[model samples]
Target: MPPIRYRVQANGPLRGTAVIQGAKNAALPMIGAALLASSGQTVLRNVPTITDVANAVELARAVGAHVEHHPADRLLIIDASTVTSPLLPGDLTRRFRGSVLFLSSLLYRCGEVIYEGAGGCNLGTRGLDWHYRGLVRLGARIEEKAGTIHITLGATAAADLYLDTPSHTGTENLMIAAATTPGRTVIENAALEPEVVDVARFLTAMGAHIDGAGTGRITVEGVDQLHATDYTVMPDRIDAGVLCMAAGITGGTVQLVGGDVLDAFGVARHKLEQMGVTLRPEGAVTTASRLGDLHPINIITDTHPGFATDLQPPLMALATQASGTSYIRERIHDARYALASELTKLGASIVIEGERATVIGATELRGDTVTAHDLRTGVSLILAGLVAHGETVIENGRMIERGHADLVARLRALGAHISREELPDTTRP
Candidate 1:
């Protein structure tokens, strides 16, 4: 297959309005949650038209569910009434991490599941110990055979679950597994991400009794069954943050429609303000603009209600144009500094030691070819390309497409000179 690449040109003062897509983080898990319904069709509205969601649909079909997707309406209808497969395809599961979410529903519906493990971006060690421990406590037996994992559940009953860290997927997995269990389940140190809250709301709409979703502690009362229903996914906060940074990096003005940026960005909004990005929120619209020089700011990535690790890479790209040095400490992913080397390719001065990275600003960035190691890093390179001295070509554009929907089109609408192209495969000898 041909590789996908992004061709970006230096376009200044991007001025326009762009609509944010539905949250990818929320939509993936909800697809798995929808499979918990034994009958009827589960309809998801506002779903992002991304590769990850398409992969989820394929995985759902592999497990015997009938799925229909409407990209024009951003709607997905899933009917798991005929789901009887216990095996998850290794090809699909190895492509994305959201595949792990289907474990709970498959175990609940088929009593057992054979999975080939989960895979996503190479962001250091993202172990599944928390998810396994939570599932084991909830009466599921898990075993590793060869390179695959075999999980079985017999008469599932609720139990107390605790996570060493408030993992987003861990909390969602446990909540989904406990939704149809016999008793009440308490999850301690639950993830407080808005995506998790959206998943909780989707599960709630399906008749799952959940409380304290956006808190550190969440309690779920298991019901005998879950009914399919229609639910709307929330707007993508990470997408909003990236677009806002795009405006900041190009010294432009843009209005983001579909979500409240002030509340969605949490502390990151204040950090953007600290860096001289003006953000004004009115209802579902937030206007982001920068009329002056960009400033430097310190940031520490955390779980929820804090600086998001996903947004750190774009912020690093933005810091390159700042007047001074900006310090970013990545506490979430150890290998997130992988972006520093790629940024340096564009003439940005960055020093990385351990999980701490120091970005020196006011460096003249000249466009060059770079690689997108992950989704966030891919978008960060695009941000750099927006303000670069010349044309910038970003390889491995699929990474950016995994999370952001209509990214190039949306950026073009906002006056960014970016286009996606597919390079023909040249590996033939």
Candidate 2:
């Protein structure tokens, strides 16, 4: 497969309406659970055409699900009715971190799991020690060597699984494992992100006993079988936030529909309001713009109900154009500030001190070549490029599509100077 690269041109004040897709952060684990559901078909609607989804589809196939993707229709039908085993292809698992989700789902179905180390963003050490510890507490035996995790379920029963920290995926993996273990499972200090609630809703619809989703404590009463059902996932809040920020940073008016403000970004919405951005009530379209001549304010990242780590990169891009120094602290992912080097390429003054970042607002940015280290970083480069005075070509855009769908076309509709570009040669010398 050819690696897709984007050559985003600078054209803003970007302005246009965009409907958010089903949350990628939420959809992956739900798709993973489809693997362990009773022998039946599950249809996931509003699926995004991102690399992460592709990885999930690959996971479905590896675990014996008949997976079909209709990108044009935005539907991914996964038929796991005939799943015969818990063994996932190690090669496919190595490509993405979402693969670790199979650990819990497989343990539910097969009582054993052997898989490769999960991989994703290289921000910092993504140790699965917490996940392993949680699983062990739930009575699963674990053996590891050479980057592969071998798990065998012992006396399956519910237990109190306290997250060393409420690691988002860690809590999720534990939830999936405990959902069918025939006993009550209590998870404390669990991640309460909207995505977590979405998964819980899906599991409950499938007959799992889960309570207190989106709260610090969650209870799951294990059941023997989960039924198949059609589900519409919640809107992508991060995508909505990015588009809204794009509108504000470029001084354009755009009404974003199909998203609930309080459900996904309530905390960020409050912060945006503090910075003078207005968000209409539920079912009302929202718009973004500058608060007079002075820039709004500074922000720091945290877990859910705080400025999202996912939105911090683009927020930094927007902050660069603000009038005052904006402080961004990433409490979740430390290495998310890799974009500072690329932002510097565009003549933005951003200083990084460990996990914290400070952006000295700039009135103008000059276009330059930049590399996207990850998904959000790639989109941030596009946002900065759009606000620049000249053309900007973003290389290695594969990172962008790993999360956002139709990003180039959406920017194009918003009057961004952007287009997909092919590399010079398909064959290596």
Candidate 3:
């Protein structure tokens, strides 16, 4: 099979409506949480058909769960009643970072799990110290040998857990681990992202008792058992932000359908408005358009209710079209500036000094060949391509498919000329 790449040409203002996909961040964790149920089938609606979710489904099957995925319908039905395997295949687990989320489920089901760690995009060092510490406090035994980890759980007990930073995956793993442990477990400095709240609701629907999900503190009361239930994943705020920026960059208007973007994009909505993009909410649909001159804005990425690190890349691309200089401080990931050089390939003037990036804009951008270093970076380049003067070719475009579902089709629906094509097998020898 040939590698895939994205070819985009400068199109006029993107117009029409775009229905946001289900949250990839929310869907992956909930898929892991579904394994907590020993009987009955867990039906998940509004599941995005992304590569990460496909990897999660394969990981679930590797551990003995029977999964039925209907991508056309955006649904997943998982039956983990027969799960008895403690070994998570290194081949499958190493595909994406979400593989680590299976730890709590496998440990709870088989009393032991042998893992080869986790893998994802190269976004600096992401250690699992918090996850290990919280699990140890919950009475789990962990040992490392020759690059593999062995975890064993015995008589699960509740304990107080604290995170040095409000890690999203760390919070979900601990919450799921404590769900059936038979006592109340409290987590301090917990992640308040909406995805965390969605997972809590899913667990609650499965008979787990939880409180304070969308706050800094979360409490989970362990139950004797959890049963399967039907749940719907939340809309992807990151995807919505990208589409909104698509409108901003192209100087077009677009309507986002499916959910309330106002609630999902907390502080980001205001930031977009500051950049001269008007976002109007009409119940479940929100309209994004830019009719005035693009203005430069300062951004500092942080936890929820603050600017999102995931949306920073797309915003950086948008900043190149704004007048004056736009400042971006990436506080979450150290190597987020990987998109700087790629954006420069398309005539973007970006200066990176440590974690801070300064983008000088209103420079007539001309399209050029660029690389998609990661998921967000890939989407950022696409946004640049939509407004560039000529044709733009984005290499390694499959990375974008990991997060966004029906990306090309959706963008085309919004009146953008973007297409996915096969790259020749140049390495064939």
RMSD of each: 1.1, 1.8, 1.1
1 versus 2: better lDDT goes to: 1
Clashing pairs in 1: none
Residue 193 miss distance in model 1 (angstroms): 0.5
Residues 1-429, candidate 2: write the lDDT tens digits: 466677665665667777676788778888888777756778888888788889889887877778888888778777777666777777788767888877887777677888877767777766788889988988989998887788998987789889877778887888888888778999999998988988888888777899999999999998888888788778888888888777776777667766665557957877666655566655746666554543646677778887788888888888888777888888877678889999998899988898788888765788888898888899998888878877777887878888898887777777877888766656666
TM-score of each: 0.98, 0.95, 0.98
Q: Is candidate 2 or candidate 3 better by TM-score?
A: 3
lDDT of 3 at 62: 89
- The digit string of per-residue lDDT tens for model 3 on 294-381 reads 9999999999989999999999999999999999999999989999999888889999999999999987788899999899999999
Give the candidates in order of TM-score, highest first.
1, 3, 2
Supply candidate 2's per-residue lDDT for 183.
Answer: 88
Which tens-of-lDDT digit does each residue in 1-429 have in candidate 1?
Answer: 478999899878999999999999999999998999999999999999998999999999999999999988999999999899999989999889999999999999999999997878999989988988888888889899888989998657889889999999999999999999989999999999999999999999999999999999999999999999999999999999999999999999999999785786878999999999999998999999999999999999999899999999999999999999999999999888878999899999999988899999989999999999999999999999998898899999999988999998999998889999988889965
* Model 1 stretches with alpha carbons more than 4 Å out: 426-429
Q: lDDT of each structure? A: 0.93, 0.80, 0.93
